[model samples]
Target: MHDPERFGAAGPAAPTAVAAGCTSTPRRLHHHDQQAYVWSRVHVNPSPSGVPGEAAQSLVPPPRSGAASVVVQDKLYVFGGYGGGTGRLDDFYAFDFRTCSWEEVQVLSEEKPGCRENNGVVVLSARDQSIILFGGYNGHRWLNDLWKFDIATQRWICLEESSPDMVNAMVNEEDETNAAGMGMPQQVVNASTTSQRPSCRFGYVSVVYDNKLVLWGGFDGQRWLNDMYVYDFGSSLWSQVQQCGTLPSIRSCPASAAEGKYLYIQGGYDGLERKEDFFVCSLDTYTWTQMPNLGRTPSPRYFHSCVMHSNKLFMYGGYSGSQRLGDMFAYDFETNHWSEVDCSSGDSPGGRSSLIAQVHENNLYIFAGYNGQTVLNDMYKCRLRPIGIPSPSLLNDFRRLINDPETADVCFLVEGREVHAHKAILAARSQYFRAMLFNGHMRESSDNSPVEIRDVSHPVFCKVLEYLYTDTVCDATLEVGIHLMVASELFMLDRLKSICEDLIRGEISTENVINILVASHQHNALGLKEIALDFILQHLSDAKIQGGLTELKSEPDLLIEILKLSSLQPVTPFARRLGNATQHQVLSPGTEQQPSQAQQVRLFNAHPAPQEQQPLWRVDWR
Candidate 1:
């Protein structure tokens, strides 16, 4: 039997929340002990040129939250946001993250862009160069003007059409707080572009991918857009790519990053709901694919920031539906896994959203953001290190088992491939394996020799062994999960079968419902079958709109199964007759009973396979 304590499998033990932000003076010896731990970490707070190393310094720009920040040549430039004294002041300031100092450079340009927050700022040139600033919101209206900042000259220049210059719009920090959605009408001019500029939007997702700035999924004043526009610096033109496959919903404030030839999008808010789904678009195909996360992950959030460094995607703070968050997570592209990050000890930026995180020299420079209530203008640096925080790595151990298995008494050679496993673990996890290995059932081969398994392919059999060791399917896809479900059913491993069932259920739609229903029925997965039927019936309108029911009559097996289930029970007034039409099924509702189609599907009793009919697993291979 698997020992819960030995495997640390009872439940995940939550780790201690690490500290961040600036802090001085050790309050207690306990805190001093934490400080000692901090020094061991890579996080370092460098002092100003003249100040002492341990001194608390001042590096204040204007106190404005929701502003956009960018790093150009080790100098951090912050753009305009909601200023208290002035109504959306347009100002530019720069700070040095390394030295912890601020410099409000003089804007030499005669005209400058107006104030805004969550502006899409990207480094056009990283070699001591310039940054491209795009549309954002002021207190009242969203601005679509684009501006470019020259690091050497310390001036602002309009990259797009000119707007009303706001060079003198500086707030004294002595007036009432400016409300969002206040002020100017920020009129948008028709840009001279091949594909037309993206609509004036805020909370949009933009990132640099394949030498092109890709912008997609943002909210205009009236509606949200799911269109994608790409701006090429070399061509100085914008073109909207015809996005195909499963397009993400119309949303804003979703975090995205570009890696290799793929752009990954994380959580964002759709104005009405916060989404936690993860998706990726391939530059090769430009097709969108949604991938399921492996384990515990961050909750639904928006206004978060994603930065890619060393092929790993790091996530910073954002606002969930209920509150602002100060958590961090890292996603490994190679492993297709998500792991939450825990800092050792230091003052963190705390829970906030709409902030900017720029990675420079293996360190993250986090700038001001709004934490639901307060608009902050603090600068913090998170130095990445191998923080040996405590967490049971059962998956890691299982991975080791795959690479370097041990204590294997019996070997399974299926389809000319070898799979190693321990008899005790298999017996504890699978009943069929238990009966074949430990219940004194003799196979064609002797106990000391390798067993030649049949029927199942190596990939499917590998998933079975994976479940026996790790209780998970390493690489679960729709096809793989279905095959595993079949193997799980044959092996009498109900829990493993349920894992596959749940994964299959998550992807059930009009296109795949019929196939899943067939698998469920064929494998005797009664629960999955009911769930699939209910999904189709519950969301019948969606299936019809998406053309999922177009093939309803084409499948003879599915038709027979539905009719068989209906024929097994007497039709009542609430129960309607399932009429197979050439195009659509019209439920013949009796006058005495008018149940909805969803309710009617639920009324069909799909009894569990009888105990006697369940496979006896009594294989007599001669």
Candidate 2:
């Protein structure tokens, strides 16, 4: 799938080992009849500009075998490796390409489940990125613990072991949801049964395929293995696929790279023999095919590192029998061939094995590994240049113009609504600055014209835009939501306006009814008041509003304000009935009451009843 000879050593050299720090002497190339592939050497130091040093406190030391590594979001993550005195580590570390540094990441609730080496690690692109680690050998006993690491929330979880009862339960669940409504139990039962399952193996080659992890060739204590198995993450189930067609007879330490639907396996030892032969397996067809012999392949090696970059596969230093090599090789997938490149110019490290190599940003990063006698703790970046160019400037007159007060008054309409162009223009310009910093493309100016406005703009809209850019919620009160709503409305941002409206709607839960009422009235957010009134009327009786009315009556100015809001609104019939009941008061018969109807008739002729009848009516009924 990937070219296997993309970064190898090119020129010919009789087998020789240069001392550490000595420049690799470039040997003259033979004039072959075939076209020559010229390679230029550029030596990169072990410690690049951003890479952390071995002595750095944050730098994680390279662990011995039995480690698990994965790449997520351009960062390489290493977890749970064995170190001599440290035993089995449950710690996690991440290497950032941007920072070129290794930082220790604490895996919350980490438990030293077991010490293991040569474990099978496969990164599953499921549930926010997780690495699944299976079966590894501890010092004495072999392990079958299946642990998963979540990248988003740095944590490790061990999967529960599956049993026959669990399998039966799963099968039963599947049967109820079967297609064709067959309601057949035997079909489900037959599918659950499996034979020739891969014995728990360590140091296996595991790769992701069709959302399943396909594992092949590993050691199982007694012998090296070539058995293949597929683990489905969704089902938490393992099934052994038929090992088809002349598999690489039982082997270990094979390098693997997956491209398209085919997995290419190369160079590993088969107990009695060191092999250089390579094979390709079609995951879709479940068939293995041997690749045609490429002239002058890398010497037979095991435990070498292989990484796919830009469809080209790069192989780095590893052990060939007793010798540890620092040579690099690249393979061309189109021609199914290997080519050696000139990597000696860059500050190449000494020969090593058991190293880890990962590709990021078109560069190969090689971490610490064993250099025959001792374990080394150095990191190197191999810079591969497809082409070169000069860096361009990011800042210019246009950026300064947007920030200047003279030009800041320019108004623009993003979605047919007028807004101050300064903030939006500046934000768009900032992205260009970032691109330039990251060595990305320069920003190009657009021809769109700014919207001209005659009125003084609202400062709140500017504040809201500032919050959007910086994520700074200056005012977390209801006012902020109101301001956001106004800005969204003015800018015609329906989504943003909806979000603000939602927040405004949520404010109805506030305990202070008066504040809610005032905010709702000011913002014309009647929806909020409806919710507030619903709560108030349900929990507080007429006594509460009456008390408020009484207090308002004591203060004339406040009463005027209260009366403004108390005007006729759509109240329920029950509330109107309650108001009528509270308004009428019967007077005591003995107490001196208002003038009789006769006196009102003599004074202003307002009464229709006779004087005698009025006095009788006024008498105490009791």
Top-scoring candidate (lDDT): 1
Instruction: State the local distance difference test value for candidate 1.
Output: 0.63
lDDT of 1 by residue, 1-622 (tens): 1112211223212212222334244454442442211212222233244546665544365555557766677777777765433435567777665555565667776656766666677666455367777777654445556666676786666656422332113322331134222322234233446536666666676666656677788766556667888877767777888998888898887888765678889988776878788888987667898866876687888878888887778888887766778888888778878888774457677887767677777577787666655556666767554443466798778656762446666788888877787777778877788888866774532556667787688888887887778877776987777777777777888888789878878876655676666566666767777877777555543423124332333344554455555444554321232333311333445434443444333333222111222111121111
Best candidate according to TM-score? 2
**Candidate 1 error regions (>4 Å):** 1-57, 84-89, 162-195, 387-622
Estimate the Cα RMSD of every predicted model relative to the unseen true structure. Answer: 27.7, 30.3
State in Å the error of residue 526, model 1. Answer: 91
Q: What local lDDT does model 2 show for residue 231? A: 71
Return the TM-score for each candidate structure. 0.49, 0.49
User: For residues 496-516, could you state the per-residue lDDT of candidate 2 as single tens digits?
Assistant: 556666776666432344445
